[model samples]
Target: MYIVNEGPNNAPTRGTLKRRDIDDNTGGTPIIGIPNLHIDEGELMQGGQWITYILHSDGISQLRLVRIDGQEQQTLYCAPANTHIANMQLSYNGQNVVFNQYPNDGGKPSLYLLSLASGSLQLLLHPQNDLAYTPTTWLDNTHILLTSFIPNSGAPRNDLYALDIIQGSNQHDTDLQKLFSQNWSCGSFDVSYDTTKLYVANCDASNGLSATGPTTISVQPSMGGTPQPIAHLNQAVTMLRAVSPTMLLLMVENGSGDTSQNGLWRMNTDGTGLTRLTDDTTGGQSLCPYSQYAWSNVTQDSKLFALQETDPHSADRKLYYGSLDMGTLTPFADIADGTDMRLVGWTLY
Candidate 1:
């Protein structure tokens, strides 16, 4: 598996890439150790042959691609000065990438699509008036799920929409379809692996940006239908993903003073059984302490996942692996001493 260590505490935030052996559970070997490289906004392409990442230096951001073994690196796109690249998602077929570009100072964000083979770029969507669109994930090679919202309006509801890339040409040919029957406010959401159902956590966003109230978990057809309420959580759900058609994994914020309820949780798709997989208890006594989870950090099979947690020996955020069927974790590798890290994605290595 590959991971990116982000130096958030450093003078200028930078990223260090490393690779780990999942089966051995050993420390990671550094792959890239260049100066001023920010890799937090990158992902491994499907089939694990290539990687797409962003590089930042001197207030400029460039989109680049590299082979799996850290060779043949090339710049794919160069953004305008003072702009940043974010929310980059490679297509399922590994031929194209869709991402958002925003100015560092201030302004609304715009979406774009890039062809990896020819290095061609196209403007996909731009915000008009109060309405804005942001790419969330790719449903397939041709369809992408996006969130449509009115920025800074405190409306409490941000809807989901699907963008069909193959249906037409140019900006006018982009087909936007709403995925819900009514105005549904969702905080954390994921679609089933088969793309049949959509699971949503209705967290309170009264403050416009953060989830501050109880959350209700619901399931509905991915296209559009009546939502079926499943589980209700007192703490806000920060992250969640569908492990399968019948199971889900979620992480709730540690706000209720329960050490056992801080890290990771797993439950059924229909909300039958709920289990705690890890906790915030430290001192090397808990299963996983000070853990952090990501939406796309799981393996290809979805049975295993990678997360960052404090290493008891070094006090740095390290990579840990947990199973979908068990709560115990196996120590893998420390990301970078005294720096925060994130699992980019799993590869065939």
Candidate 2:
């Protein structure tokens, strides 16, 4: 995994270890920093054939694709000056990648597709008065589920929309259809591998804000059907991620006070058997929640990867792997200081 350089000596803050291949997993000599680099997002594509990351350098953000083995780094496409790329997704075949680019001067963000072989970039969708920000799971090679948010809204009141890759003579026809509309604020949604079910978390009970005591987890069909409330969490859920068809990883806060005291929890997809994962309950503690967590199912073995903070200021956050069945955790690596690391997933080719 590639990480930005933000340490004491400007060293590249990155380390790699093979758990099954090494006995002393923490013996590697640390590299300091890689200069003039910033990685915003990283994703695994095409069943882990390649990993893609967005890098910001020289005042521009460019998409960089790398082989899963940490070899063959290549620039896929670079955004125009003064524009920012939002969420991105790679097709199942690994031939295409799509992302949203927002102009600095303010306007709607447009979706663009990049061809991996030809190094060509094309505009996929450019909607007026609406901006696409979050890239959800890919429905197919030619379609993706995304979230559209209104500009200047302080709260995250976004609607889910599907974008068709096939373009028409009329621009309006390119925008596909709205999946589901919610009255509350929602973010961080994901779809199942079969593209039939969607899991989304929202605080519909709070008026334009996320507060404790009222959050809903909804399971809805991707084709615009009635949403069934699978679970009504007593505490406000801050983040929700799908581990598989039957399990979800949730970060929640008890509504009585600040949510930092809240830890991690796991539950069935239908909202049954909620289990808390963390025991830390100190208020105003930083747990490095921005880092992404993913579950790995290889050889019928289920494991989870996450960034855990051993310090309050998050200055000593490290990666950890845990067994889902036993709930036992082992430290993987200590991500260097000054760099906020977000682990997407392990690429097993």
Candidate 3:
């Protein structure tokens, strides 16, 4: 398994671990180190051969694509002199990659796209200072869905937009469409495996970004329709993914010392069979302390590769794997307490 060691301390490191070395009761360490790279957040390309990630080193941030085995690397794009790369998403088909740029070290972030086949980078949308842009998921190889709202508007809602990856193409060979709009600001969204429905988290924006408010889970048509509520959550949702056509994987934020409010959860699309897969306890003692911030850092295979930060702000952390069918948990790595670990999963060694 591949894991990222990010810090409140040192340069980020990447390494690989053996799944066999892990068990439910004991933790393990990386078996090999990935040279001198200082980047972390990544997702596998559709073919599972390459990974796209953001690089933050020296005084620059870049969007990069690297081969899985560490034998080759490529810098697909780099932020301008005083700017840096921010949010990013890779199409499910593995052809295109899109991300945002924070200019002047501040201001609205603009969206950009890169073509893996052509090595071409294009500005898809300009940065709007008042409105915030967050890439949600790819509807298809050439289309992506995202939500945006006025930063700190304190309003109760956000708008969803669809972008065409191919310069001259439309959603249906016509024009991109607004899939859905609601009264609640949606933090993130996912499409069912079959790509028929949109699963979203409707959140509160009172504190600034809509992600911080009380969150709710709902599903609606990918085209346009009224939403069908799934569950009203007490904690803010940090990540939401559809595991199967009828099931979902949910991670909620509980950074504070409230054990009951955190952990990995799974439920049916209709909101049935909900289960907490880890201990969301707050403390310096609990073996598993889940944080919503790293929710997107995952890799799925026979089971799941995930983690739990010991505290909201500390480096104490652990890597674990669990059964998607039973919601059973097991510990794989016990990162040294105070050793900030920013991360992901996959097997390269």
lDDT scores of the candidates, listed in order? 0.67, 0.59, 0.59
Query: TM-score per candidate, in order?
Result: 0.82, 0.79, 0.75
Best by TM-score: 1
lDDT of 1 by residue, 134-245 (tens): 6777766788788765655655436788888775334532357888632334357777767777888877544344444477899988877889999998766766777666
Could you give candidate 3's per-residue lDDT for residues 1-349 as a string of tens digits? 3445444323544433223234334334443344444553566665456666776666667777766555467788878788877667877777887777777635666677888889977777764345656665677777777666554455543577777766542122124467776544435567777777888887654444334546788888876788999888777665677755666777665433233656677778898888776655643222111111112333344355455456645555665566666657665556665554443444422
Which segments of candidate 3 are over 4 A away from where they belong?
1-37, 127-129, 149-157, 167-177, 181-188, 203-216, 232-237, 254-261, 283-302, 347-349
C-alpha RMSD of each candidate structure in angstroms: 4.7, 4.5, 5.5
Q: Candidate 1: list runs displaced more than 4 Å.
A: 2-14, 149-157, 167-175, 181-186, 205-213, 254-260, 281-295, 310-315, 335-337
Off by over 4 Å in 2: 2-4, 7-33, 130-133, 168-174, 183-188, 204-210, 254-261, 280-300, 308-314, 335-337
Could you tell which candidate, 1 or 3, scores higher by lDDT? 1
Score candidate 3 by lDDT: 0.59
